[model samples]
Target: MQFKDQLDFVRQHVKKNRMRIFTTILATTMGCAFLIVLASVAFGLQNSLKKEVLSDDTLTRIEVYNDGNKEIEPTEIKKMKNVNAVTMNTLIQTGNLEANIDAYKGSPEVILTDFKENEKANLKLSKGTYPEKADGVVVGYNVAQILLSKEDEKKLEKEKDASKINIGIQESMIGKKITLNWKNEETKKKVTRTFTIEGVGPKPKKEWEQDGTIRISKEHEEALVQDLKTLYGKKLKAEEMIYRTTAVYATDLEAVTAINKALQDEGYATYTVSQQLEEMNLLFLALKAGLIFVGTIAILIASIGIFNTMTMAVTERTREIGVMKAIGASPKLIQRLFVMESAYIGVIGTVIAVIISYIVSFAANYAIPKILYMATNEKEFLTTEIQFSAIPWQLVVIAAAISIGVAILSGWRPARKATKIDVIQALRQD
Candidate 1:
């Protein structure tokens, strides 16, 4: 039969049994609401998980550190089949000191990430290129201030003092002179070296871009070797200060395993990005399941409502069913109609749920973020830049399926009662 006819039939049944209709409607509404809300929360949690667990840097590189108590040898690295390009380095941290050039051996933390001990760390470029010579310096905020003349410091400081003092001495710092001294190296006599500020670099971060600091180019290694030879005046035994290593873009999971094994044999700390992603996946999966589990409880209560409505429907139509049987209605047809009534209840609930869910979802599009921020205390958590995809079409289908299933399950008892109705006995009793 067409839905219009079925709807008319539904109206007749509902008008004759107001309480049953109302109960069914309430139950169906609850079921739909539960499913829709759960879907929305699942999607939101997934997005947050993605942003936090798989930050942008995960796409670019893998980090390796020297966790071994001893040294990582170059020869051991050659044994790894999955290794692509590698940059192994050591950094020795030295404390602050006063120095002079044209009168500027500034005291920015000097990081060495070069082939030679004296070469400067490779700072991320900000305005221009890195320094050319070993002793060429780059400076962050404090170092930049110290290198500037007292009068110039006051002037430049006034010009942009609010900004971090860090600034690089890239190619622009070439030919600029500064005097360098280290308190640690001072003997009874004063020792000093005059180095041209071959370049100034912007400030550098150990693992991120720096706002105020400098970087010296790798080319400074040659100058450093010569400087060290001069300082020692003979053969020198060198020590590695820090080890820097990274993994390449592996095409498969097996490739990650291979790379990790290689780094371990070489005595380096090893890990892959996927391990973190796996944990995130497990967490989000558990959250979704938990929401579903709670929502199932609501649906179960709705099922009870469905059962009561169907049972009452059977009672109200008792005489009508007996008359139909007396008029030669087949048992199969009577059973079909009763089951159809239950399905009808499900369809009504599912449709109303969908319509109302969309209305509420649109409202939530504005409200949820504010609520989440208030709960979490993160003001930036709800930026407009986020892309919230709607509930998938599949979820809509699933919601409908659940409704129909609940209706059928709850209608089974009434269907059986209708089957047992004896026309003679029904007519004689009522």
Candidate 2:
């Protein structure tokens, strides 16, 4: 039979058995809808987690420490392959440095760090720009918060909110001059210098990003280190130089692992977001697999309904099949007719499922956040958005393909049985 004729024949058969077709389509619609929702939830969670974990500069940067017995020089670390830049971060509170915000006494400890001339790209700023010269300082959000005055703190307490106060402090401290007093810890002699606030950094998300730290030019960093050695009256060895943490920027993300491993091989302890990302991916992979598995159960049950419906259609059309065979219609045409009928049911069912899935996805996204907020008045629900369901175009296409394929497979045995119907016996049936 011609392709158009076969399609018409399938349509007529479906029209004649509308009840049976409706039953099969209903099962398919349920199955396909479940599959879309489950898979979408998995994708949504993965996306949300990626934002929370890999959103920082950790992907392209590595933090190395002096945890190893052998200390590494900033110069030696910079010479390593794939190392684009290296910054020595040294803590200044214990290193004969006293910090104050205008006149605020006993200022919080500040971290003294420097940026390489060629490696400014390694720093991720939130509020202001990086310091270009020695007399400029860039502070973190927490550091800015610490600089809040008693009046500011009292206002925050009175209002029972600190978010605005934090923002005020960060905004106001951007151009203020911060005084740093340097002294020989033993001799009690002090030298005071004031540095202008050049920039503000992002509020600390991870623990390491917390400490109130400031960055200066590499030239000034070296000057401070030399001065510290002089105060101690000894020529400090490269290992003996007081360093807190080192920021190592890779040329690219792919280079992070290699450079980190090389540093580890040299007896340095390294921390990078890459390791956390890998772990998170593995966990999400397993969770998605479980969700898909549960969803497939519904599809499988729907496929069985299709199988049963096709079998009954074959039994009812036995006499018609016999007539077609005797009139020179090929068994291949007979088989194709049954398969096409099943595919039509699958297509219609998938269309309905897609529509319903979209409605549910939208409802869930809009409603879940509101429900959670009602239960807990946390601002994170309002601030940090979480999508419970997100359906990507790729997933929609794949689900359509799978639904049609399953329907065709389910009709296979019934199609084969119809092709094998005996003309003589089927024609003699009452």
Task: Give the winner by TM-score.
Answer: 2
TM-score of 1: 0.66
Tens digits of lDDT, candidate 1, 8-67: 765787677777776787788778777777775676656655775555434323456556
| 76-151 per-residue lDDT for model 2 (tens digits) | 8888888888866666534555667864433555556664432454566776677777788877667765555667
Measured with C-alpha atoms, the lDDT of residue 89 in candidate 1 is 35
Q: Which runs in model 2 stand beyond 4 Å of their true positions?
A: 92-99, 103-106, 117-119, 122-135, 142-144, 153-157, 164-175, 180-194, 202-211, 216-243, 264-267
The TM-score between candidate 2 and the true structure equals: 0.82
Q: What is the C-alpha lDDT of each candidate?
A: 0.59, 0.78
Assess every candidate by TM-score.
0.66, 0.82
Model 1 error, position 27 (Å): 3.2
